[model samples]
Target: MNTPILLLQCLFLVLLSGPLFAQRWTTTSQESEQQPLRLHGSLLFQGIYPGFRVGVERPIRQTDFQRSNGRVNSHQRAVLFYVGMYYHPGFHLNTFAGAEYIFRRVGGRGLITEFRSSLALSRTFLGAETYRVGEAGIVETVLASGQFYAMPGLGFGMGKVLGKPGSNRPFAYMVNLNLTGLAPYNGLALPTPTLEIGFRYQLATTSVHFRHRIRTRQ
Candidate 1:
């Protein structure tokens, strides 16, 4: 009798957990009817500081003698940009596609600019506790120089819903720990670590609503 009761209790708890978890992670719009679809886009700028090792040899002439000199040092200052579309189903899509422009200064005198297409899939992982969340993804980038590469990446994001005091609208703020390029490249024989920080603002019909709340209410 105790065994049967234990089994039934386990089944009941399993059934209840699914709906509870779904509710915690999802929100529904109040609009009785769906609004007209609107296309969305975003502009992103990322700065990268890369360290490189270069080998140089110079001929030396002194006292009727000839010799070769060599030295090694690391160079820095690299930047990249992306302008792309934001698309989703009910604002819950994990994939993004965009074009990227990269700029790098090499040997303290050379600048290289390469254009690439980037695709990524991002997921939000809620921790054991509801408030702790992290984001991770994989980005595949292909450059115009005919090189293809993939990067396994991770990030951290935090968001909250802002409700209007006297109106119906929602707003959210998020910060991210944007990581990219975990794999090595093939065409250029380039293997360098890349990392950056990013901040994002999500604007919706609710921006005005939040303003009204602060202005009209006590």
Candidate 2:
């Protein structure tokens, strides 16, 4: 039951993020490059519930180590802070911290592949449940002691840079296959795959100025 719930969650998550992903993809441009700060929203499907998430990400190094990276930068790193919710079978809210590593650039249109890892804490509110505790001479019925869960996860995905808000900086869309394990996962013992799709908006950047440029006379 738990496995199915988790799988269905992933499937639905992909569906939810799919449209937004496509929207971002179409708007991508070769002129836009990577930004240092990122703000994003996502739909998360990982358990028996469908969820939505928002996050902020920033480069690990503020200094310009590769400003010259014209088409693609080899060294790009960031840390992400996120908050999300599930609105199904059980109401759950999750908060997590993650690290992102950009591995390869897929094309000239600001498309890239990356890897991410995260640790999350989730709280689930169980509606009207009963628990029996027997003492020396008395028995007690307890109702509703919510459950807390911890999940550590890893993911692989591809992303595209979307144009920024007022400025044409860089916004991004990503689709990731996430593998996560929950301890005492509602009586389930296994790692589950979750699909996450989302968009990122750049707030600020160190510099997009290319440090090096090749010139050829045609």
Q: What's the TM-score of each model vs. the native?
A: 0.26, 0.58
Worst window of 10 by summed lDDT in candidate 2: 209-218
lDDT tens digits, residues 41-70, model 1? 222223333211111111111011011222
Error of 2 at 17 (Å): 39
Off by over 4 Å in 1: 1-33, 36-146, 151-154, 160-171, 182-218
Give the Å error, residue 42, model 2: 0.4
What total of clashing residue pairs does each candidate reach?
Answer: 0, 4
**What residue pairs are clashing in model 1?**
none
For TM-score, the strongest prediction is 2
RMSD of 1: 27.3
Q: What TM-score should be assigned to candidate 1?
A: 0.26
Per-residue lDDT of 8 in model 1 = 98
